[model samples]
Target: MKKMLVFSMLILVLILGACSKKEDASNHGSVNDGEAPSEFGSIDHGVDENKVGFNLTGGTIEEAANVPAEEKDLIIRSFDTYIHAFNNQDLDEYMSTLSEKPKSFNLDEEREYIESVFDEYELSREAKDITIVKFDEETGESQVFANLVTKMKQKSTGLETKRDGRQVTVFSKEGGDWKVNSVYYMEDQK
Candidate 1:
C-alpha cells in the first residue's frame, strides 16, 4: 500500500512539473506576466501607411523648442493633418500641408521617398500604442513616436515577409507649419 501511495505521489509531481513548464512558456513576455510589448511586430512590414516624408536632419528637442509658440502649434497641427492625410491616402490634403514651392525638397521628391519607404517596410495592418516621445509645447515642435503592429496574412503565403519591431517618426516645423521629416524603423534581431 505504501509503495502504491509513493507511486501516485510521483505521478502527481510529474504532471505538475509538466503543467508548470507549459505555463512558463505561455507566460513568456505576456500581458499578465509583465508589461505587454508594443504590437508593432505583428504588422506587415512596419510601414506607416500614412507616412509621407520626414525631415531627417532636424536636431534635438532643444533646437525644436526654439520655434515660436504660434509656429509650433501650426507645425503640430500640420503634422496631425499629414498623419490623417496619409492614413486616408488623401494626396491633395497631404500636398497642401507641404510648402508651396518646396524650398528644401519638391513634392515629387517627397512622394518618391514615401513610396520607397512604403514599398520597403510596408507598415502593419493596424496602428496602436502611439506615444509622442517628446513634444515641446513652448517651441511648438515635437518628436512623435508610435508603434505599428503588423501580421502576416495567412491567405498570402507566397508573400511571406518579416515584421518591423518598432517605428519612430520625427516631425519638424518649417515655414510656419510642421511636416514629417524622417522615419526610423527598428528591426527585431530575432
Candidate 2:
C-alpha cells in the first residue's frame, strides 16, 4: 500500500515538472527573434547567450547602424596593424597602436622593457576567437577578447616555442582613432 502511494506521488511530480515553462538562459529577454531586443544589457548585468557580445551592425541581427561601418573598420584595422607590426618586429609601428602619451597602460610600461623582450626573441602571433565584449557607441569605449597562439624563437639559438593564451583589451576612440587603453592577459589555455 505504501509503495502504491509513493508511485502515485512520483507520477504527479513528473507531470508538474513537464508542464513548467522553459526559462530563458539569456537574462530572461528574447534574443534572436528577428528584432532588436527591447533592452541591451552589459556583460556584468548578464549577456544574452545568443547575442553574447555585440551582433554589432549588419550581421545576423542587422543593427550595424549603432557601431557604424567606418568605426568598426578603424578598430579592426588598428588591431591588425598591431599584429602585423609585432610579427615583423617593427616597434615603432607597434607603439603607434598604443594610446598617446599621458595614456599609460602600455605607454608607461617603458620602451626599454619592451625592447629587452623583443631583443631576446623573434615572435609571431596567431589570433582566433576574436569578439567584441562590449561597446558604447556614444563614448566609443569598448572591450575585445581573443585567443592567441604566440610563437617565439630565441634569437641566439633559433629555438622556437609556442604558447596558447587569451587577452582582453580595453580600447577607446581618441582623435577618431581606436587606441589601446589597457590590456589584461588571461591564464594559459587548457
Candidate 3:
C-alpha cells in the first residue's frame, strides 16, 4: 500500500509538472521576450525541464498543523529552509537541510543538479498546493508532494523563465531532526 502511494505520487508530479510555466506571457517558446540571456558561458542545454525546485511549507490549515511535529511539522520546516537557502544561493546552508547523504532520482547526484540551478539562474519558488501523500510512523518516513511554480532568471542574460511541475520529497529522521532523504521533480512545460 505504501509503495503504491509513492508510485502514484511520482506519476502525479510528472503529469502536473508543466502546469505553471504555461502561464507566463513569454513562455510561448521565447527565452526572454526576444533577447537572449547574456553569455556567461553557462551551459544552455536548451532543455525546458528544471531538475531542481522542490518546495513545501507549513500547512496553513489548523487541522493539519495539529499533528505531532515529528511527522508533518518537521517536514515543512525542513523544506521551507531548503527552498529559501537554495534561492539565496547559499549552497552550504541549503545542503544542510538534507541528510548527510541524500539521494535524488539519481544516486548522489542531487548536489550536482542543484548546483547547476544555482549557478545558472536566480530562482524563486512557491508551493501551490501541498499534500502529504504518505507517512510511515514506525520508520519516520514521510512523502510530501506539491504543485510547484518557480521563476528563474539567467544570471548574466537576465532571461527569465517559469516552470510548473510537481515536486516530491521524502523525509526521514536523522539524529532526531527531519532531513530530506530524496527529492524528485516533474516539469510539465519542458
Candidate 4:
C-alpha cells in the first residue's frame, strides 16, 4: 500500500509538472490587458538570490506577516479549504479551491487523480510553517510554502503510511478569487 501510494504521488507530480511547463512555454509572450509582464518568474523554478523582491523562503510566521493582511487572509483561507476538503473527501469543495485555468494541470485531470486517491485511501493532512514566500500584486500571483504531515490509510487493507514534506502552493487570482494554480512538493528524506 505504501509503495502504491508513493508511486501514485510520483506520477501525479511528473504529470502536473510537465503540463505546467508546456502551458508556461505556450503563454510565455502573452501579456494580459496590455500590461507589462511580471518580473517574478514561474514559481516552479528556484528563487534567485539577487532578485529585488520578497525573500521569505524561511517559511516563518514573521515572514508571512509581511504580506498584506487581506491577501494573506484570503490565501490562507483558500489553502485551508483545500486541505480540509481533501481530507473530508468532499470533491466539489476540494475542486473549488483550485483554479479553473490551472498552470499545473487541467481541472479534469486533477479531478480524476484526486477521485482515485479518495476512492482508495483515507487521508489526513496537517500543514505547519505556512508562509508566503512570494507575492506579486500586479500579476495576482503568490507562493505559499508550508510543511505538510500526512497519514494515509488504505481503505481495503487498512494499511497506513505517513510522510512529511515541504510544499509550495502557488495561488493565482481568477474571477477575483485566489485559487491554487500549481503545487510543488518534496518529501523529507529519511
Count of steric clashes across candidates, in order: 18, 2, 7, 0
lDDT of 4 by residue, 88-141 (tens): 989899999988888755677577768878888888899998878778888898
Candidate 2 local lDDT, residue 68: 62
RMSD of 2: 13.7
Q: Report how far off residue 169 is in candidate 1 (Å).
A: 1.8
Identify the candidate with maximal lDDT: 4
Cα distance off (Å), candidate 2, residue 171: 1.1
- Per-residue C-alpha lDDT of model 2 across residues 50-78, encoded as one tens digit per residue: 32343222133222335666777777777
lDDT of 4 at 49: 30
Off by over 4 Å in 3: 1-70, 105-109
- Please, what is the TM-score per model? 0.40, 0.60, 0.59, 0.68
Candidate 3 lDDT tens digits, 47-158:
2223222222323322233346555767777777877786687878876877775543222345566777688888888885665666666866666666778788999999
* True-structure lDDT of candidate 3: 0.61
What is the per-residue lDDT of model 1 for residues 148-170, given as tens digits with 9 covering 90 to 100? 44544333243546454455555
- What is the descending lDDT order? 4, 3, 2, 1
Clashes of 1: 18
Which of candidates 2 and 4 reaches a greater TM-score? 4
* lDDT (CA) per prediction: 0.49, 0.60, 0.61, 0.71
What would the TM-score be for candidate 2 when compared with the true structure?
Answer: 0.60
List of clashing residue pairs for candidate 3 = 17-164, 17-165, 17-188, 18-188, 18-189, 37-157, 38-157
Candidate 3, position 146, lDDT:
69
